[model samples]
Target: MKNTKVYASYRYPSQVISHAVWLYHRFTLSFKDIEELLAARGIIVSYETVRNWCLKFGN
Candidate 1:
């Protein structure tokens, strides 16, 4: 229940959001770079969304 709330109201899965946040903090990549990385894997997320995710989920 508590865990679900962490990912509530998001279109993408928890795994995707967590991965994006991880990539952002775990490396020197920018939002666009992470966006492109996900895009390469057919994720199709934008940099702005990446930024939001980082803000919301990143430590």
Candidate 2:
């Protein structure tokens, strides 16, 4: 089976996005928390941007 989903050009790797989403759901943290945690790893993400990914293309 083939799946179809559109994505943004944030250039993040799938694993990173998955981890972000997992934390977002598992810990019940806000997008800002997720963004900051990822940022400390030198990912340079914004809360609004992360929220959009969560709403749209997060896995």
Q: Which tens-of-lDDT digit does each residue in 1-59 have in candidate 2? A: 12222434547766677678778878989999998899899898888877877877555
TM-score for each prediction? 0.90, 0.72
Q: Could you give the C-alpha RMSD of every candidate to the true structure, in order shown?
A: 2.0, 3.5
Error of 2 at 59 (Å): 7.4
lDDT tens digits, residue span 1-59, model 1: 23867898999988898889999999999999999999999999999999999997777
Instruction: In model 1, state the lDDT of residue 19.
Output: 89
lDDT of each: 0.91, 0.74
Clashes of 2: 0
Clash numbers, per candidate: 0, 0
lDDT of 1 at 46: 94
Top model by TM-score, which number?
1
